[model samples]
Target: MTAAVRDIWRHPIKAHGRERLAQVDLTVGAALPWDRVWAVAHEAARFDDAAPAWAHCRNFTRAAGSPSLMAIEAEVDEASGRIRLTHPDRPEISIDPADPADAARFIAWAGPITNPDRPQPARLVRAPDQAMTDTDFPSISLINLATHAAVAAEVGQELSPLRWRGNLLLEGLAPWAEMDWPGKRLQIGSAELEVVEPIVRCMATTANPVTGERDADTLGALKRGWGHQICGVYAVVTQAGTIRAGDPIEVRP
Candidate 1:
């Protein structure tokens, strides 16, 4: 059976944090625009000029070992080209990494604090859409919240989609069921996403993006409870547009 649409999440910056929208319009032959459009990458990395790969950065990397990241919030300000990071008592940090000077300032402030051995300095790289990584869309990734909940219930614990790092979270389906929907098609808002591959689990999923901590039992839980830790599906945008929360998703069974 088709399912009800729940919350729609868009991560402006890959692997950092998510932004929620109510609804979006579908564009012609494209996925959501500017969704995961920018990525922060470590220096001295090479990408296949022809073949696209999922490129990630320390910012998007989770700190599950330190769940404190879940408590932080990031607000990206396009006008000033800065990211305002908030962590309760800590002062707000307006980060503008585009400028070499600004990037250096951010590196000096956040580097040792976040990871002392993560190289002495960090430079932010702008990864274009031409570059590809694990994300199946020019602008989208999908996860079934229902499936995640089922896995948690099966394993007897509370879980979060942070383990999967999906671009879109669709609720209202059965647990571990989205895995069976590969090769099927579903409609999100005005967008049509073709379920393609089964997401392979990784250490990134086990690490909390915020704290950079690890949870060894995380992947094991997925393997035991759901045959695999795959919680949602990936889709290449067959169509483009905006997708927001509460949109009725049409699934072709």
Candidate 2:
């Protein structure tokens, strides 16, 4: 069977918003370009700007804690280092996350949507030479559309794949086929990647991207139908190449 790329996505700021791409150039030993490259540290976070380093997800504001964040969509301008964010409940705003001048404005814009009980957003920080992914290591998440369909069917609702926050959405594969792919290599388009492990799901998957509301019980569906709370696999790029939508994914021996 030939699995093909259905969509490509990146979240420039961790758990803040997502951007879809038609094509991207992959680099060896790197996560998807600009994916989770920055994160918003909360007021109670321990991250030090002077000495930025890889910190745990708990240090940032995320969808799992604030479902409203899921409703955000992002558009990034790589050349200008600016990001434009839009949400259903708020006016669109654009800013350069690296600039200190725009930091306060960003926080105020997102403040209303965030959970009042959770630690409020304090600042935006990026560690040099690191992507703020959930995993300490740089990796890309590959999701099987078939498996997503299965989960949606089990839940008796149409779930958006965005809930999973995966980098690559693949189709034409059997449901849950990725579970057996750890330690295997896959060639997609011209890029090669090695499957690392299954992604253990979190509560973030229950939120609806359109409304940013926890309307679905994805965890319950996964546990009841599959006995595990995993929907995708993490992969590390092994070969540098450009990949595009419609690219065929081939299992490499």
Model 1: lDDT of residue 117: 34
For model 2, the local distance difference test gives 0.93
Predicted model with the maximum TM-score: 2
- Find the 10 residues in a row with the least total lDDT in model 2: 98-107
As for model 1, its CA RMSD to the true structure in angstroms is 4.1
How well is each residue in 1-253 modelled by candidate 1, as lDDT tens digits? 4565666655554444455556756555444543554444444345332564455433333333223334345666657767666654355667665677866665454443343434333444555443233554443467788767766676566666666666667766776667777788877766777777777665556654445455435677788875666656667667665576777677776
lDDT of each: 0.57, 0.93
Candidate 2 residues 127-204, lDDT tens each? 898799998888999999999999999999889999999999999999999999999999998899999999999888
| Reference-based lDDT, residue 57, model 2 | 95
